[model samples]
Target: MILAPYYFNEKTNLSEQPYRNQKRRLEGRSIRDLPLYSQELLDRIRLPAERDLNDDPCWLRTYYDPSSEDSWGQIQDYIDTKIGGPVTVYNDSSLYNFGSNWEKIFLRAPQLLDNTCLFEEYEEYVEEALEEGIESESGDAQHAGENGYDPVEDENPWICFYSEYLFRLAAGHIYIVDEKTLASEGPDAGTVLVMWYDECGRAIRYYREEAMHAAEIANLAPCYLKDYACWDNAEIGESYEWGAPLGPPYGENRREASE
Candidate 1:
């Protein structure tokens, strides 16, 4: 269940737009990837803060270092001390003293427990990173690259995560589905269905479903995933006919098969 004992879960190079023809026109050129996004934009996405600090609002932070799980807990502590403990506030004045007043109420939102921050935990961890306009502490949540993520960490095994590096984690598993197999079987709980075509003109399933849970991937086996939603994707049903009603005789139901 313990995988990469010493990897961090923080990757920040995913929020960039690829150039139109940089690779072909400019062989030896590079440019800044992440353009500035306004803090106001982030505020629109943050959760509203508590009653006293309603002006600032709260934002959840994620860890992306991909090397340390302890950092998440430590950051939580750091945030608490910076804003206010769950029930206490050290600085009455406001982050405005630091010119980021909007973040004062958000420094450590008092109501994080109201909803889950990310898909993994059912609790929210508040912070002020959103006002800074930089990706939050947990990790970048926007884009994914093919070969840059790993989900297991022996050192930080408590914090289970997914990787989009060389392999992707579907819901949490190494999603591997071929066309023939996709046609044969439908989707699973966390798995997603993808559509790719072969010479025969049949819509094939190329990817497997994501892992059932983060805990499902606590092992050493490698798994890669492409982000997708089942019952979705253009090619699955539109371009290709992957939606034929399967014949009867379904596999033994894992359920009680209600009356």
Candidate 2:
């Protein structure tokens, strides 16, 4: 999902006359010709990377017209035909949006405040389970207690609780549609069509009004949490073993984990 500017043959000057003469046939050009045709021009025109049309958010333009609301159905239809199955279209707010993004939302620090009531319930459950250690006759509940009853030590307890609440919070936000349903009938709006097709192309989870652009999701979420959080008695240059420093790029332990 991370995209960078892919370069084309720099010696080819496409803007002058040869390419402009083929304007009518531009739609017929394949994605392989994009660097030689489109992005070079976009960069020549000085558009930012987010609007570069080659990136994820803008890349949707290659599939359907963002300006057209009806394109959603066209998207579903194309997938259906390719997959040879009935296509189902749901809005971005539908039940089909559950995925990695939903998990990230719950795992973020801001979620601790967003779902306070659920966290309180988790705390109560943990307290009760710890108190009822040996005598709890419930099979699964008793089994959970046998593992030393440490929520922090045995990551499963909090994971189970967080996952349940995350599912509840994410309901009606995930959307699903049939494969290749994207180009249902045909598009009249002149939006780009699919540049590439994979038989195993997974359904993309999207938001209605928000693009969930990579920069916004990956960079902004942690900073937003830092801004709203309390920083009492915070010391600088202290190498904490758990979390990163209270600022943007919250990834102090990231390299350690990867290593």
Candidate 3:
């Protein structure tokens, strides 16, 4: 019942235009929390690869217009149609993989993915992008987050996103890192990382703890956590072993396991 994922809202899509904005979606939003989904609920989704994602409004654009909110709502409706109830989703990446310019590439579909992907790249790109530096058309990424820029549209409107992050199973305890916004009123808001695990139990890693975008989730259970955290100490050198560092690009890893 690990509930980690990159849920998207339809309105989160880039403005329907030729030019791309700087606000790449899903830039940074990873955290650590206990298993919210019940065993029965987890069982409902039999697919080892199927982790659920929902509307993840970015911290910058906290307030969504009615239209945008409604678009996000539609994604929820679709989820309800399938699972029936406020279903919980286990995300594929680590706590660090949340933030990035790549989100814009993955928006508007069942899942998020690597920014640069081809046939089976999404399946592999998510993990691969983390290892190297991207030559962003818009070089100012720090501004990209603050300036509201998004990844340029992909070749296929239907084929957005690199791919859903793959999952590796680990076991341990859970940690939580919840963010609090001070807004402009208080001191500049900063993030807080919390570790949730049995005092007696051994500690673990939060999935996707490498992206540098997400903060740390100390003491979380490694069991069920994704082993290929976006920004873990593990380094991706000059060469690649398999396809992509993270997942199957396009043609691979598409089908959701039967629930």
Candidate 4:
């Protein structure tokens, strides 16, 4: 599964703060009393013709089936055209940490253990570790301790490691968009052109195809990939915004400077 950030339409009432503020109950102040809450603001906010308000931007999750011959072909073509040739696995010795149980599992039964099983096993291990408070000599455990594990937090390195492991198993290597490349190339580069293969080359390139916009706003490029069980159920060719060049306010300054 590929997850991409939602691109919001700026020329919409939903995108305005006043419209969003209407949903909230202002404790002491009237909604109209707020700054920028005026008829002028409402008049200025224009909805796109024939566009549904419900069609607001949202993070998109697209699933592809590697099992299907047709789907697999498309996936391969995309990797080849967009991501370039896969890096030699031997070049990056750190790709598969021999110490990881996930790596061990992959070596043992790469076909048998799906994503769900890996997640369950990871959760189980975390639970066992937390319950027992066993400070092991293993690198992962030591790293987890140093990072400070919190059950509620998604930022846990342990969880991130497993997530990447699952992605790597499917793709064989991951490519991350380089920061310098983004700054230099801007949004026109897209995620494809700016990405570099991760030093740990176990799998395919995983990136946010529309991350240039993200970089413009947040100054960060986020990337993630997941393997799903219900790949057959998802609609093919429904993953919109893949490989599309980023829109305005992203590379505008850089382009202007160059021009």
Per-residue alpha-carbon lDDT of model 2 for 162-188, expressed as tens digits? 222112221112122222223335432
Off by over 4 Å in 4: 1-142, 145-154, 161-164, 171-190, 193-205, 208-259
Q: How close is candidate 1 to the true structure, as a TM-score?
A: 0.16
lDDT per residue for candidate 4 within 1-259, as digits (tens), equals 0111112122221221222233244345543564765635643442221111221111111222223234323333443344332221111123322322222322322221222222324434433432232223123455554534555663333332233322322312212222322333445333422121211222222244444332222222122213321111111121111222212122232234345
TM-score of each: 0.16, 0.18, 0.17, 0.17
TM-score order of candidates, top first: 2, 4, 3, 1
CA lDDT scores, all candidates in order: 0.24, 0.26, 0.25, 0.27
lDDT of 2 at 45: 47
Model 2 misplaced regions, further than 4 Å: 1-157, 176-259
Tell me how candidate 4 scores on lDDT. 0.27
For model 3 the TM-score comes to 0.17
lDDT of 4 at 258: 40
How big is the RMSD of model 3?
Answer: 20.6
Question: For each candidate, how many residue pairs have backbone atoms clashing (under 3 Å)?
Answer: 40, 19, 54, 6
Off by over 4 Å in 1: 1-22, 32-187, 194-237, 240-259
Instruction: Give a tens-digit lDDT track for model 3, residues 93-114.
Output: 3322233222221222213221
Candidate 1 local lDDT, 64-153, one digit each (tens): 233323433443344344433232222222221222122232244423212111232211111121111122213543322222224442
